[model samples]
Target: MDGRPSFLIGGGQAADAIARIDWAATPLGPIGQWPQSLKTALSMMLLSSFPKAIAWGRELTTFHNDAFAPILGDKPQALGRPFSEVWVEVWPEIQPMVEKAFAGEATFIENFKLTIDRHGYPEEAYFTFCYSPIRAENGEVGGMMDTVMETTETVLAQRQLAVTNAELSHRMRNALAMVGAIATMSLRHATGLDEARRQLSQRLAALGRTQSFLSGEAAEDAHIYELIEQSFSAHPNLRQRIDVVGADFRLGSNQALALSLALNELITNSIKYGALSKPEGRIGIRWDCAGFRFVWREAGISGVEAPSREGFGSKVLMQFVPASFSGQARMRYESDGLIYELEAPAAAIDNT
Candidate 1:
């Protein structure tokens, strides 16, 4: 009765709009008049244009905006009905969340998955939402406000990436098997223990090279010319004694290391027990490829037999070569000298 005409003033207009006035049929009368400022602010906030809604009476009422109606198709019709009555099917799953929110506790969930049957079509969705307690005039928890966002696409994409990585690993292992087979066939006929051991060591070195390459490792390849140059560098007098005649072939990182070691062992053995040990002896190293197969031979060992039992050098040479490159080593003894032979798949020997 102050006759201030609260509705006529700017602040009074807001209070009047915020005041509760039931839209659905209810047992209680219209909510007592509220200040105009409070009413105006609340009227705008509850304009039914958002996707989330406020629930009163323990989520029994839908203070929903138009934005939330489509997602809850028929629920809007039961505005003042008990939540359990309207969404009884989902009650068990949603009950705990509602209880926590109503008990004045804030709860948050992320990427929460759920399946909803919409118009007979089941749709899966991921949701992130928070339930916050809403307070009443007496400062007591009255209901809850729900805010949510959808994130279905991002979750599915990550699952797909995991599957792709597994497939890649399988293919890589299969390709390695093929390479191993070629290395074994390459050194199948080395004429003597010394010759066979040298070829075997090379193949093993090649295998090590492949492993390194797979892990993105790199190093210089061993060139036949370079090996010869290094060998002769140690003995300027022997430089003319050894004959290396062949077109230099480029080797892949894998081939380079293994072949280099094999050549090194051969040279060392020749110096100690082969033709190089005799001032009048000569050594010849040569190679040729036919179709998909490569052959390499080392001749001139002063017609002497290398040890049969093998030493550390022999073990390393034999085990590494064929095993590394998937090839084989062969040894033969001739009245003339020793012959070490190597034969392998073209693919394994091809530098390209």
Candidate 2:
């Protein structure tokens, strides 16, 4: 026999590397002098397809199989180095666990987070692993065995899912609050079933339009012109009478949603009672991109008046929509026509 331990034979690339290494230069001394216990443990470790490594004796020298290569990523050669040196970057975090293993305690951890410099830059990573004590011929704890698998991808996916679920829950709660408020208002003042139904429909339509962009199907930010275009798409006849003039640009998600809903409420009011209700009715929409101001004007109509009692639409225009954009809104009930204006800090208008 060549006298080489059988574990050093036929381990594929890792085995070839082991045979070429000079054990005399290391703390483990020469290959002929290795303990039988270590040789047997290594033989079993090399035969398995699992990613594992052994850190042996006072030097904690490292020995690993071909299956352990991916765990090392682009790390320097680690075959015969001290275990702590091989993972020096994370030594502080893992030192306790290593100590525990050598102290005859078996430690198992799942999705343990770490920051490593594997690919030339530091990045977050996670792993699931076990560190077990390896016994010596005298029945004393002599070394440690590390059996590990990367779990960075699975951990990140779970975090993303948790964030998505939280956002969905928050939105549902806000929507339910708005619906309950509207229902209370309608029931308190509703004169008849038809009137109550109409009020709820108008407000719900505005809310529905708000959700179209917030539902993740649409871009997070939308242009001013797109919001106006979508709000009036169903009213082809009124759409022709309206003139929109603005230096169009994208608005942040919150601003876009508020503007879209407010525009819908305005369009509904004009159709039912303002200029759009008359054949000679005309409407003008303009935005001051520099000053962050918007105006809706109705002309060629007479005797337009505000509702006697403030309803859900009133609350949306005067309170909710303006508050959403950190702005103020004004509605004029004049004999000539109805005019509405909203203004806010230019910096606050389109955050994106």
Candidate 3:
């Protein structure tokens, strides 16, 4: 080591470390013997806040600033090591870029993915950076300088947003298809334009309400009672005449939508001609866990008889709604009233 003080003209920890380094013991011999191009690049890197590194000579010995230290993570001894040895994990991916720079061709890459072991554990990362060649006094390529910035967080956020957008688009398409099916079936059972329009509007409104419920934070599953209550909210007067009793079970979004629409149809029919047609009329709904059995019984209407033909409402209760959950449904008209029963597997209501 020389007795004269090393002249380091920068204000950072990296600059101070450079001043104290035993350059005589390294491959480059001593700081006084360093080429002008290497000295100038090292000065700029030590003074800047950005992460930068220099790989000089045939050995590609590494020299980096304090700002680049954290990027090396657990490998603190990498400061004076060869670039290839320090970053061996990603050497294969970056070798081509380094070769291009050595050939006097500068290169830039954005959001380049690399699997690195900076934290002792291997993990994927992203970076945007440029590699430029440095020339010696004789005009020969002597080394490469790299200015790099990590972009892992930004890249991951963009990927997550894309997935969320795709899911929302798929849900919208399914909802629109369900609305079309409801409109077609309702119109088929109507005797007049006015009746058809009324049925279609009511069914769509019920569908909209269910969709709104699922849009909330706890959207994955909803209680069976909450779904049934939402169907009757618009007809507050009929709520008093309906009795719902069962152990509350959670249903997935699709199951909730189908069941809500079925309940709306049942209530609408009762209001028009069944138990709800009379002041004293009432409907009882009950369910149990065994096979997910559900029963709906109506009482207090006179002259009750099974319809000679099936209507949209009857089909919804006896066919469509139950089929949505892979279940079976049965309907009967006794001398006194109407009865509907359904049985479904628990998995059918909860699985996607």
Pairs in clash, predicted candidate 3? none
Across residues 1-352, which tens digit of lDDT does each residue of candidate 1 receive?
4343333233232233323335334632344443333233334435534456556654355444445556665433544556565556566877799889888899899988877544455577676778777777676776667766666677777677676566446535643563454345434456666866665565455444444443343233445465446434545777676666667766554555455555555656666777667777676666664422223333444457757755434543566655555667665555544556555665676366
Query: For each predicted model, how many residue pairs clash, with residues at least 3 apart or on different chains?
Result: 50, 0, 0
RMSD of 1: 14.0
- TM-score of each model, paired residue for residue: 0.40, 0.84, 0.80
- TM-score leaderboard ranking: 2, 3, 1
lDDT of each: 0.55, 0.83, 0.84
Candidate 3 lDDT, 1-352, residue by residue in tens: 3353333465377777776789899999888888887887788887789999988888898988888887777875765678999999899989899989999999999999999998879999999999999998899999999899889999999998898688778779979998888899889988999999999998898888888887773466678888888888888888988999999878877777778878888888778778888888889999987678888899876788787788888888888889888999998887657888888987676734
Off by over 4 Å in 1: 1-24, 27-50, 73-81, 168-352
Q: How close is candidate 2 to the true structure, as a TM-score?
A: 0.84
Candidate 3, position 4, lDDT: 34
> Residues 5-35, candidate 2, lDDT per residue (tens digit)?
6877767678778888998998898888888
Which candidate wins on TM-score? 2
Question: How many collisions between residues are there in candidate 1?
Answer: 50
